[model samples]
Target chain A: MPEEVILQAQRELPDWDGQGFSLLETPFSGVKFKRLLGRTRDTLRELLKIPDHFHILFMHGGASAQFSLVPLNLLGDSKCAAYVDSGYWSRKAIHEAHRYCQVEHAAIAEDYIHTSTNTAYCHITSNETADGLQLSLALKASTPLIVDMTSDFLVRPIDFEPIGLIYAGAQKNIGPAGLTIVIVRDDLLGRAHALTPTVLNYTYQVEAGSLVNTPLTYSIYLANLVFQWIGHQGGITSMAKRSQTRSAMIYDVIDASEGFYRCDIPPDQRSRMNLCFKLPDEPLTQLFIDHAAWSGLVNLKGHVQKGGIRASLYNAMPDAGVVALADFMHRFRKQYADL
Target chain B: MPEEVILQAQRELPDWDGQGFSLLETPFSGVKFKRLLGRTRDTLRELLKIPDHFHILFMHGGASAQFSLVPLNLLGDSKCAAYVDSGYWSRKAIHEAHRYCQVEHAAIAEDYIHTSTNTAYCHITSNETADGLQLSLALKASTPLIVDMTSDFLVRPIDFEPIGLIYAGAQKNIGPAGLTIVIVRDDLLGRAHALTPTVLNYTYQVEAGSLVNTPLTYSIYLANLVFQWIGHQGGITSMAKRSQTRSAMIYDVIDASEGFYRCDIPPDQRSRMNLCFKLPDEPLTQLFIDHAAWSGLVNLKGHVQKGGIRASLYNAMPDAGVVALADFMHRFRKQYADL
Candidate 1:
């Protein structure tokens, strides 16, 4: 959502790179598109600092699809995979993995922690968007590690040595919604089940250069623009620093609110990307949401299942936006403190 | 590809519906996104004249994924599925189907003729984009019929009564590449194999409102604009007429060229969307492609497997483009006649 990226896309909507036709008008297999695809992959590789041994796959179906794909691809001879049920997204991954193989919940909830196991692989949700929980542990497992970094991918730099696979839906830190970025170690390519769909097979996808079919060309193009934007913003290191500064602003407000606003998760497990909190009651929460919306701040409502309020501090969210939210929260508490 | 749609999208890229955020900046599960999703589906339903009994699914992974999905979903108790090997896409569909069930090649190549079979379903590529072959036969089968309408999905009206399911990747006549439109009869739901991935399962997709995960929101939004564009162009009947007229212009040029150019597919089975033909040799073909590119008519190169020229005349392609192509072809033949 960077202004430059949006303006570039708008300017190139009818014609791409002076090509006389839009990017959407190009054939997926054409030389021009192949170059675009290569440029996109190269830019992403540079941005993520992906090791040469890892295959960066541009796939569809979002990170939700990877919940099944991970098990289907990595759970070859083993009958079970170890999973840490941190919160909402981890639970969804666990549920989906059950269709492919038996999943062992190594730990659950606030007490959830990853441990080495004899299972095929260990899966963890790096950040849970719904419950505002995140795995900040220095996770070590005997088996390969699969991380669903849907909410906080590329928000910070991490060591790729211990991770066998990393998948993220590109809606949050990455780019758009439809595209899924799967970074898999080359050693794990041909381990998919025989019945796994061809498009979902890591080996086939890598061989096809993610052009197994006409890929989400426009989405990938937008993702490339996002990658460039990230580069301009000093890459992941700068993004991480900004993320901490922004999240701390609102968390500081919540901490000093004198029981007015409460964040349930322990500080160590709280997600920097999505902060979820509660007011005293449902009516108060509704009023908080309405007031926020009236002040031109929208999408601040909490997940219906877990009522309260939630604020997403993604990489694209500016520090000023977070400061505004903090200021509004302080004002609202003063206005309703006597109630 | 319409100017109005692209301009509207460009205008809305920075702020959507007067909201102080871009559509890409909105949460997929938010109310604004839900409304956008509903509007897209409603527009598609109105454009395609989809029946109430059909569950329209907006999915990812494109038409190639459905090559595996159809067999995985519909081939429950039946060990075999009937498939007409029309051309490139049908063969790919069959190859994928072989992973799930025994595929009975009802017919192959020019001998392809649809017949009733006691299998799970009869699959066919309605228009083969590569070989420029199409199934013009009024297909009837004892089992359900699954059609891959990738290239020419909405080029003409289709009868929904006999067809059990219809899937089209959105890159062609629809919109962009990330989205796939699946129109499934209600009875086809809940019949998927237990091992089928949740995202690929029709029942799950329908139940989830195609929000099983964050879908290709931007692609779906563009597709909705394309549907509106089609409606403004007098709907499918008008589109069919235009397609015929445009394709006829090119076919007429080929017919009058004597031996200079040739289209092999029989007239009845030729695809109106993709017009494929060959010049005398590789050099001539290369020359033709270069000349076409010089004239701002790019992406006219044929599929490498089919070693010829293919001009895709999708619904978005205007009449003037086709006329220009025909005029160019005539001039190229005249200029190269001596060689």
Candidate 2:
């Protein structure tokens, strides 16, 4: 992610044409900013193996902003779009979509419970960050797909076809916050509602080379750096393997908890990013979190809706960090036995 | 600008928030990653005297982006806008507005010459870079007004009641090149066309306190440092005086040239920021520029539309730099006899 940002900055800096000022500085035409766009776009196309028909746009407003932007851009009329209620994050996306479009659910697994009822965009969160739910049945028969892979983007490239658009804020595995990286088919860019801001209008940014105004150059630069970092990690193939290894260590401990700890998500549909667990009850969970913080393990508190705790092992989380966390969990169970 | 970029990076730097894992190493948000917003919004707000009624939004894109944004936010189909076209920059703003609304020429001089419209909301460059045209009109006006003070924002503080909004690019007197500072009245926000991008929706940003997304933190931090510099220079009051003194010496030579040299703009309307002049015809002008380059003068070319030498004496352009140009100009005017 870091390298991706630096590369983008480098492309614009020193002025691509050897012009005295950069594209960001000069009022030149789109031709100058075009080279930088071509590089980032082509790189994503190859990495995602994106079909030739799609167009990629790096947009503003994080995923939080995207909730309104996506529905405003993609949802036409109140037609119910199919949204698989995966967890807290997916639910939030749905709540926002409801303001602009109707949503039908293909599957829902919010708190260990799973249900299916297929209906607008076959929308789903690839991995739920708050509740640690990963969708298992993904191949859809006939529906335009909109996947919110904010948590798992680039860890493994998407293979199942006919996906309409995939959007992710650049704060996670992609880059940093403030930028939502959108991969829309060329057709999707122009399908926005009439009320979208020119800056958020995928079609406008597409035509304008994202120079509608002085862009968040520094943040975009940061995201570009992250892309470079992801590429250096041998791209998505390697990212998937590392993610699996990190999740397995903690999953092993949970499976061996001997009833001292418990997890909710079904085994077939487990997440590699966020691992949520409960320590018997409220008091015990609080005590363990306290001890963990003293040990420099922080932000271990679970989402308020999901009591217990969640350990987020993102791509940047060194394998050693996960190992240490798993070891802490093991020691915590032992301490309870002593008590 | 630098702080925003740095802190935003720190927040996404994995283990940020002491989370066992951060989203940055993976993908950005919607994917559920949170990047830094910056240390404090008030740090920027307090420096600008931005009225509390208006929410401060740090936006992406440059002042050019604002060309489309201003019309979207401030003028609807029913409302007519009048622009005082003093030079090329105002004409550009008028061109962008033409796409959205009926812009009227409230006043414009013959041959794009420099003079005071001195009317309400008379949109002018305040400090023109390409032609070195500056208006000596008083800031107070009977009608609401907007000014693209891109070249000399914060160079001085006027009472500001008569001004509706002021937009400035950070490259010149403000800071670096990537950020654009827009100080608009509370009522003018969110008044744009409904179809504008949410990114360009100043109303949305003003409401969000500019944290609508990760802004160009680095460039904005640099802008903040510039504000501090202004503060150190006894605010804009002292800045206006210093610029006046520095520019007087140069303009004095041209105004009193006795046909040796010439400037298109009226002496009263001459710019203190950028000063333009010529030595009779094309031959002598080219020769003067060539000799001046060897003497350390650079970027003195005039706008292609208005051919003459232009010196941008921005806030960063020290008094010494101007004296150097003046000395070189005087020597060049005298050194060649026959030409």
Candidate 3:
């Protein structure tokens, strides 16, 4: 939520392109809106360095929908797909994929097992927001890899070659909720199961120019602006450096806290985007969350299922913001050590 | 597109409820976000007079998704469903439904016919934007009726009886693109085909609080604002009256043109939301479109298949806008008399 993007949306809300109508008022199929869509796609392709062989689709229903859609689209004649059960999101994706195909766990939680070579595709949550786990970029598989990059997309450089598809919900690093970005290799387009919902059919969406239905026009517009912001911030290279710097500050606090603060994720597997940790006890954890909130570091509470503390350091998070949180965590640990 | 609603969204964009984060930055499952969803549902329920027995779902993928979802959700063990071929949208619905079940044309375009009583349900487009056709509110059927009110929902009072489901894409009168509102009777739940996509499943959407995935948060917010705006504009009662007046002005002008313009839809079946008409020839039609654009009556060109002019007078359309279009049409016809 860059101030520039929000302000631009506000200014355009009254009349888009001086058309005496809101950008939301533009018809999804109209030339003006089509231009917006095309510009967004072009800009994103440039920023992400997406290969020409990839088809970028702007879809709805978030990554949760992609959890089901990926299997429906790629499982074609294969009855089994391999999935890495890295964390919360990966487990959810695995559960949904079971409806359409058999899901074999390639890697469960912290284990780094490989997928069976005969599987349709290997699925992985590149970064798990809730559990603070992430797959290394150098990780490879025998089967085509489908990555749920929801928490880490565009935050660093990506190698497109071992990947069949990469999908991310836009709420985190991309733009906003309600829009999902899917980058699928062109060869994977026509393999969807016949029963797949037309809206979720990648081929159908590509054919319809992502105007398969009325798209999230405003969300796409905001994403376009966010993409512009990323371009302004020196693209993924700068974002990666910033992300490492921010996450390290907080991880440094946890590592130095001895027994007072703990992060369960293996250091090598920890997510750069989300840092999850725990205090010595539940009450202390609650106190940490309240203190963080009072100090203007909100949404610091852990996801209810995995209670402790979790801080999301998304692309929009300023370096100073993380520095402040790291400082707060250090002060809290010292204050509570005597308790 | 209301200025007040847009401004409110802009103000709230930077920080919602003093949470020190953009509204878009709030977690989908967070308490604040859930409250926003609940308030929007309640406000919409109150405004639309939705009964307790009906489930109100704010979904994505727009009305086109519903074209497929209606059959996948309602057709059940019955392989046949009756659909009225009212106009462009109805035909599209029928075509999409064929992928899931056998479609019987209950009423072909230009005909009013009854569906077989044994069919799963009868479907109709309440208002056809391209052809300017609408089903009368008094129409009844032995089987339950599912209406695609994409172009006219909330523009007038609707009868609940005999209708099992009513769905509309929000871009017209409700809010913006990317969100679809589905009102389904409780009994229709749990009847979806086993192969139905989870995101489009009525039961799944309900169970997940319409959060089967990260919903179009901003779109829902805008829809909530539009709902408030509807209330401010004296509710649907006022809207219906305004719609009638605006449409009548345009229709009157067409009627008085005496061969200069023609509307093929039967007068009684003509849509109050979309008024489609043709001039004497293609050149005249093109001239009319060019002239309309010059007069600031944009998006007046009809659907390519229809090849004429279409003026959409949705609920948000001011009576003055329609009057101006009518005035422009009158003057255009006078200038082009020699042609």
Name the better of 1 and 3 by DockQ: 1
lDDT of each: 0.85, 0.66, 0.85
Collision pairs in model 3? none
What does DockQ give for each predicted structure?
Answer: 0.77, 0.21, 0.65
Give the interface RMSD of each candidate. Answer: 1.2, 6.9, 1.7
Give the TM-score of chain A in candidate 1.
Answer: 0.96
Q: Mind giving the per-residue lDDT tens digits that candidate 1 earns over B1-339?
A: 666777788788877888777777777787878898898888878877899999888999999999888988888787889988888889999999998988887864453345445587888889999998877636665667788998888788887867899999998888888789999999888788988888888998899999877788888788888988899999988998998889989998998999788999999888898999999999999999999989978778898799889999988777788888999998999999787
Report the C-alpha lDDT of model 1 over A85-171, residue by residue, as the tens digit: 888888889999888888787863353345445588888888988898888646666667789997898788867877889999998
- Model number with the top DockQ: 1
In candidate 3, residue A155 scores what lDDT?
92
Give model 2's clash tally: 60
Question: How many residue pairs clash (N, CA or C atoms closer than 3 angstroms) in each of the candidate models, in the order given?
Answer: 0, 60, 0
Give TM-scores of the second chain, every candidate.
0.95, 0.81, 0.94
Evaluated at residue B205, the lDDT of candidate 1 is: 87
Ranking by TM-score: 3, 1, 2
Indicate the worst ten consecutive residues by lDDT in candidate 2 chain A. A111-120
Model 3 lDDT vs. the true structure? 0.85
Predicted structure 1, TM vs. truth? 0.96
Score residue A112 of candidate 3 by CA lDDT: 41
